[model samples]
Target: MRNLEIRQFPCLSDNYGFLVHDSESGETAAIDTPDADAYLKAASEAGWTITQIWNTHHHFDHAGGNAALKAATGATVYAPIYDRHRITDVDHWVADGDRVTLGVHVANVIHTPGHTLGHVVYHFAADRVAFVGDTLFALGCGRLFEGSPGDMWQSLSRLRAWPDDTVIYCAHEYTQANAAFARSVDPDNPALADYAREVGEKRAIGLPTVPTSIGKEKAANPFLRPDDPTLAQSIGLEGSGPVDVFAEVRARKDRF
Candidate 1:
């Protein structure tokens, strides 16, 4: 908290742009730039000079701002090695286990390849912070754009393994839609219903529903709750494996 500060803003309609700043070192980074101008405006308001661009995947919404932001701020760009062909201007192509230094903070890269074959998240373990691009959302996980349901399920588990207090910074404002899908599949889940109501109220006020804690998501997010007996049973997948249950849930969401 001392050296690291984070600012988030809306971009590209539903996408959320984030800027991370190191107070002591004065190095700030834009995470998965949904919009270059939005990131720049937020950084400018915070009086932070963008020094790095950290990309989570190759998706346009995520990396569309890479070139413009880098050109304007001369920020060093870091991207997943698996998708460097599509995600351009990456000064450092990183992979799982790679460490990136943001001033004195060290971020460990976690390769979560379900969203994309090369999707990766930046986890600053020491700071209990993670910037997960499109891999996981508030109440929902990303659509299986390029990976199997099993792949996404495994990736979610990696994030779940982190401390419950880890603050998840994900892109997008899809909680309302995800919550609706969850209730349709797991109607008896009180936790999910309660959280969904809260999300609705927040959205009504044009508030952001992100930066949710891993613990909070663990309790209410159906995508991450495949292990719950009620959730499995509601979807008629009791006794099934998490991957299988996850697949069913994702398929239902695809139509929802």
Candidate 2:
């Protein structure tokens, strides 16, 4: 199978916009439209017309460019069904277990609520790639805006089950700060310390800190490691359930 060529660039100061293209078929799709002009310029320069948009949530920074991008490229917009009323100009409403296509590549849609009730991720399993939006980040996860910690933990658990090799593509440049918080909680983690240094080096070189693998996240992502005995003990939540551990971690992150 030919790999999908992914183009990622910073948008709106912190958010990232991605364009995934099937090299064999020339079909391309934008993961989210943070800025239409940036997406347009990038896609045009790459010589691929965006035929589709897969929006993960209803946040303005994530879907704000939908109208303009669709008007410019006539792309079909697909958004999570749960928040269809809030997200505008959606041509298709997708629910969990739905599949979206980028040429011959198919992405399984996983509903991940926490940051937003309608948030979803597109996991192209065969290709080992996932556009996780804001649900799962480099060293952390999104805040609880419309869902509970349990809801988000269940969502993360689902993501945690994905193939360890799957490369996670998140939507922000917040790894440096997230790494700092992860260190504070997972202080004894040698892997996290090393990963934090790597993240710092990448940022110093103006490199993106995303496309982290599931295995890498499993090791260094504090949000995904709530059950770790060391983490639980360090946070003074020893013997707590995974959900409560997650809740505490999230609360600390909020204050961090």
**Top candidate (TM-score):** 2
Model 1, range 1-256, lDDT digits (tens) per residue?
4757999888988999999999988999889877899888898899899999999999999998899999999999999999978998889999999999889999999999887989999999999999999999999888888999888989999999999999999999999888898889988878888999999999999888998989889988888988878888998988998999999999999898
| Pairs of colliding residues, candidate 2 | none
Compared with the true structure, what per-residue lDDT tens digits does model 2 show for residues 35-72? Answer: 99999999988999999999999999999999999999
RMSD of 1: 1.1
- TM for every model, in the order presented, reads 0.97, 0.98
User: Relative to the unseen true structure, what is the C-alpha lDDT of residue 9 in candidate 2, on a scale of 0 to 100?
Assistant: 84
Residue 254 of model 2 has an lDDT of 99
Q: State candidate 1's TM-score.
A: 0.97
